[model samples]
Target: MQGNSEVLVIDDHMKRKQQVELLLQFIGEPCKLVSSANIGEVLTEQVAWRAVVVGQVDIGSPFELVSQLAGQYKAQPFLLIGELGDCVADLPNVIGSVLEPFSHSQMTQMLHRCQDYHLKAPSKTKPTSQHQEILFRSLIGRSGGIQQVRQLIEQVAVTEANVLVLGDSGTGKEVVARNIHYMSARRSGPFVPVNCGAIPPDLLESELFGHEKGAFTGAISARKGRFEMAQGGTLFLDEIGDMPLNMQVKLLRVLQERCFERVGGSTSIDADVRIVAATHRNLEGMIDKGDFREDLFYRLNVFPIEMPSLSERREDVPLLMQELIERLASDHKVTIRLTERALDSLMEHTWPGNVRELANLVERLVILFPNGLIDVNDLPSKYRHVDAPEYDHEYDESLLEQDMLNDVFQNDVYEPPESSMSTQLPPEGLNLKEMMTELEIDMINQALETTDWVVSRAADLLGMRRTTLVEKMRKYSLSKDSA
Candidate 1:
């Protein structure tokens, strides 16, 4: 084990040196090891004692003598011996000393200290109050919550297990997904995302597993799904809980087998993709109700990482706001600032929508206050008047208040035409029924616009929850297809 220098092992019993060397290597250390049978060898290799381990030097001279030798080297080396009584009194202050018959824990701790002695510079991002966003350009938080997330990201980046991200919509699940991909060993490869809930059940199969030409009426040519596209990279599944039960079974098989085949293709294809799935639903409850697959749950549950809600980490609000301000200013080519009062107003509100909602608010404020800084007055009337958005729909309030009623109870369901309405409303007026339909459409459109066309966000803006929004979308036959 000897190489360049000597780690003076002072003991008549040569077996002790072997014990120490074994301990050092077990702890992932690469050090030149040496053994000396006598004090004469200690003096010969005393210069090398700059990094020394004196074992059982407790019998003859006072402990101060070994201490003096350590002091001469400007490295007060410690002594590890079979018994304390073996040493003459007056041992100098050694880094650490322990009696022999030491437990594995005690030995390991000593080895760690030795490794710390040879410290090197850390080659990673530093801990700072201002955390970076997914782009690594924009800052995220000036508060404690975001900082904690950053810390967790650092801790988990090097692992090769699947990550399950749990957070409400618009809380930057995709942003977290990107960060994980970038931080992992596969950073150089692509990051492909599949919104499981957004796509139709029939198409979602092809969207994830690819499709051969002639597989379906619309399949004019062969196309790769998200898994194939993200080969040797990362495949992020957004809203994974929304996937059909059958698809979940197939997904579980792919995860277990790491292989799949395109629709209408006989040959199997390898899916060498790291998976990161996100969902807002209570998956455990879903699993209990037989809505989600148990095997798939276990497979994806390898590494469950629950993202902290925005309200839980309020300290980062200011930093996130500033970053949003700068980003919006750059994106739309407008300079905007937040007044102290406006900033205070932001801090005072509970962020149910999390970072995404805040970013939208900032963008809105920037657009609304182009001439100057935004004050409390510039904030939306909803935030000013109440924490929750006002529900102005024509549904019966009494029905909504009923204990047995569902989250959203639909009255008269209407499906829009295949051709979506224009981004601009129609100029031609219609009869009462058509007008009511048009007004409802207008409200949905406004919600989408105000929330930046994010369906879940639009739902929040419309004073309904995300699940309700999806249901309403089905009833009205609306889709992002128009966008």
Candidate 2:
């Protein structure tokens, strides 16, 4: 087989080669099958093949041919046709094994697996400076907090140390991980991101590590897992705090030994990949609560980077809004502009969801105003009170305190008190309970204003649960219109 044949079958026995060819035809996939008697002859030819099927008898050694082909063409997947006892199923690039005298269904399934592997293979092309620039531009911000994150990324991108990104949800943890991968030496390799919380616990093992054919029910054919796909690349374990305790132990072993066996296979394959895990959950707290393994925590926290929330870097809001608007316009063709007052209102509000919330609001505005200008009046009601001053019941007392301190310092008209409580009180004593209530109300109002009356987000800002925040709002009789 030479040139552009999609499938190559190598078997020294003419009858076996013919049977393989007929099986390929029976599958009804439009692939040209090239039969070869010698591995040497096939290796000498120049061809781009989707997959290769090699018989054990043709190569004398059980796995030598498969290993050689895997080393030569790392992108190409191999299906070994041999007896169950002599199968070479442990190789990194070997997709599966079809036993001798295999049924037609087995041959069809193996061929399909090979095609899936070929399609999912990462591109080998090197990224250009322009591509890197685009990725950098996606992280738009000029505030000190964001600049520090950028500097931290620059400092750590060239190293092989495992990274642990800590931040609240919607703070762009995955974006940071991708930036590190693209800026590192493994830029050309695959960057596979897996959400640990999204997958079911039962299937997560097979999802991370390959499983042998018939290893479990519904596992029709052997498959190369994420680790194999991410070889020489990076594996981003997003929401890793949600990983089960059992899986955490297995993950720790892989990190320590740099090798892992497939779900049902005995051979251990080297994990030639960097690990970058991120989570919005508080892992340290989880460890203290006995939900997370402390040893695993230390292993992943070797090089930690914290992402700043939107409220922490409010100065970058305008720049972020501009970049987000441009991106939306270019990507979705839904352009819109915010008036200065509208921008000011957005900047004043606290962003509990951070950049993600801003992005969502921008998209919503784009859809509502489409290629138009959004003024302050266009804003939702929750954000309309940004210009209003907070109600402070202690304002008079604060002014009195400032005046008394000024009198003492500038006019030298005040005498020192004999004791801490010796100074005479005002005509009326302070109502401590009323003052406390006022302070609580002010804080709740601020949280509501910042989050645009999103109770869940406001609760996050106040370090409380959504239900508790709702209860407090009811006690204070607070409403979006009132705030």
Candidate 3:
């Protein structure tokens, strides 16, 4: 509690209890200490606590108070003050305890977490109807198809129904599954994704359903598979249409029974897992061809979700490009900008590989032209719909330089000189930062030399602020004597 909002605290010790009270008062937060008598009234009240601070005198049972509160209110965020008692890891919502003497920063940070929980707390009767921006950020589009996909994802995420995502390759099926998992009741649980097509046909069963010790020659020790890994969470089965016919029967049984046994193990292991399966291929067509079992199809296709291809939602390309670029920039520590013409050209060309293809192209451009502006001509030949001027194209040769120079100052028609830059990159990748640094140094040197080392004149020639040039000069340790 960092404000007037009341926070519930369960502390048996008097000294620690007084200290907590002082700290809460210092932070301008009101706290209600729950004792044995008023525990019922405190919980039964129609007020939402900022958070519950747990401080038990008995180290023997650190989770005793937590268990009691959790029983009463399952969603209450518990902050373990002073000691991170044993079994704290078992509970996902438990915040780490403060050290012996709780510092202002640490206490405030923990309380801030409680405040966040309060802001995003779900409704008691139903799963949170509020569309958290962070949760649905992956589904970025204003088109009817993408909106419908998002609506469907939101609708199905709150329920226990198995999701079947149908789409073309690279339509972000796995993304949908993830949103569902994070938005569902089992959000704290793991999110395990397994590509059904990637694993070998013979090894598929062992990959999904764990193999016991001595189950097979490779099974040196017992190993938990995806199903076990995602016990309380969602297990994303990608390319479900590609699962072997024999494996499909086993999966169908597990889905129906809500339990399974490890390979070569008799005892049934409860699979408290939610299944979200995706497939680009036509399952109905596969069933007609006798490649897929109809019974299994029915089991998985409970909540059907269809993802729109890139072509279907071409309007989202610009937004997708921006999102992908920002993500990749953070990853690579560099960025690229796409011009309107470039975006228009990309939109014109049909995306056969969908969003995945667009992501790849954005990544490629970031690598090729780091911190540079991109135009239609800079795109690959296959992706390019617009062309740049060629050297062979007929134009006035003698007056070209003078005419262009006049056009630049008069008409403000200056554009990047594509011909001046290297037409081809090396087979072995070039160092973009190093190359840029060297070019900057050379340009600066030329500007300084031409301007007779006059800092202001040189800065003007470079089209940069005098202070910026001075900083750069200092960074490079440049001096007139050295020059």
Candidate 4:
């Protein structure tokens, strides 16, 4: 609690300031970096704030500072930047070391570890997701529907309830399941996901419960199924409604008896894994049509969470787009900026594919444009709901480059606008400070608008300290929602 920074560099003489910025650039993670500044707010702010508070033993209270903030934000890790000492050896938060010269390898290692340690558990759970597809660990939305989904995830995560997430395809059912797994006590264990629909019916049984050698035509070697692999962790069964009725009965038996035998093997293996199933289809309807087992439906529906589609929470589009863009930027090192009209058009569209469609669209645009500024006309034909001007073939990149310069200093930034006014003063002299203040406020507002009022991003755009931006916002009474 003494003096803390987001990446606090304690009273350092060994190149503390410049090194932290370089380290972050190498890692390619977007985070606010501060050097030897205030740490008071960082400790009390959101638990997701990530950075290494570099402290030296001989410096003014770096150890005490890290020690205090360590417990509160365990997920927010640290990289001690100094000579190796036994004093910080036991601190659970000090995950890496930075020598006097600031090694890039050490910084990257810390980030990779932190990604595995992403908000507790973000390790890719096999075929469920790509290894590099590290996404927003926390759901990015402030809408009522998203809030309810988050509440359901939190409530069921700690308990041993079998969760059934029901929603249309691409409504983030897998995202919900992953969150539940990460938040549970079995976080340290594997998260194995099996898509019941994707697998052939003939192989569904083998996929879920494993098979002994020569059990089937292709079973030349013994193989462990999802259930065995997910021992001591969560097993996610996606597209449960699409599962064959015959397979459903077997799944129900395993759920009920909590044990199963591998194919062509008599000995039973304890099904110690937790069950978290999801489906875009309605099981009740399937049961009525005699395509699903009533018993299986009841078994998996112990604690059901209904995910809201993207159309239900249109207010969250900006935030979601921001996160998707950030993820794309981090993963592919390319970015596309959407004009206000284009963003408005997107929010108005009824997203049948839900968040998945939006993600794909963003990625596509980034791929096609890279660092281009996208107007409404620049979007796909189907996405253009509003009347936009004809796409100009000869596009100017200066405006976008300027905006990028405003943002991405730490992330977003605002450039002082070039004055159209002359050097000669009018007969009635003006207050230069007041005029400059007005210009600053106008640019800050523009920056906020550009980033959808993401304060950290806006601060980055303005090329100023986040703390400074907050003070300016306070001084001018600027509010994102109100503005």
Best prediction by lDDT: 3
Q: lDDT per prediction?
A: 0.62, 0.70, 0.73, 0.70
lDDT of 3 by residue, 1-483 (tens): 111246677777767777677566533356888644456666642545666787764443447767656556655667876566665656655756766545433565576565456545565512243233123333776566987887887778879999999999988999888888877888889999999999999889989988899998989999888999999999999999999999999998999899999898988999999999999999999999999999999999999999988897775676577667766765788977665447666866799999889888988998898877676778998888644443332444333323312312232232336885685789998997697777778788899999999766787798764435654676677768898
Name the lDDT value of residue 18 in candidate 4: 48
- Model 2 TM: 0.54
**Which model, 2 or 3, shows the larger lDDT?**
3
Ranking by TM-score: 4, 3, 2, 1
List the lowest-lDDT window of 10 residues for candidate 3: 404-413
Candidate 4, residues 366-465, lDDT tens digits: the string is 9889977788888889998877687674766545423322322343243444685566778999998798789888889999999998766787787674
Q: Which residue pairs in model 2 clash with each other?
A: 350-450
Top of the candidates by TM-score: 4
* Comparison by lDDT, 1 against 4, better one: 4
Q: Which stretches of candidate 1 lie over 4 Å from their true place?
A: 1-139, 142-144, 385-483
As a whole number from 0 to 100, the lDDT of residue 22 in candidate 4 is 42
RMSD of each: 27.0, 28.4, 21.8, 10.9
Q: For model 4, how many clashes?
A: 18
Candidate 1 vs candidate 4: the TM-score winner is 4
Cα misplacement distance, residue 5 of candidate 1 (Å):
34
Q: lDDT, candidate 1, residue 431?
A: 71
Q: 1-483 in candidate 2: lDDT tens per residue?
A: 222334667666666666666555433223444444455565543444656787745435647767777777766678887642333556656888886544443564465455555445554412222122224332555555776787787678889999999998888899899988977889779999999999999888888887988889998999988888899999999999999999999999999999998888998899999999999898989998999999999999989999999897665676677667766776887777654446657777888888899888888888888977666677777656344343343444324323312311232222334772435556888875686678678888999999999766787787654434654676788988776
Per-residue alpha-carbon lDDT of model 1 for 1-105, expressed as tens digits? 111222444554456555555444322223444434245544532232323555644454435445555555432234455443334224342445545433323
Instruction: Please give the TM-score that candidate 4 achieves against the real structure.
Output: 0.60
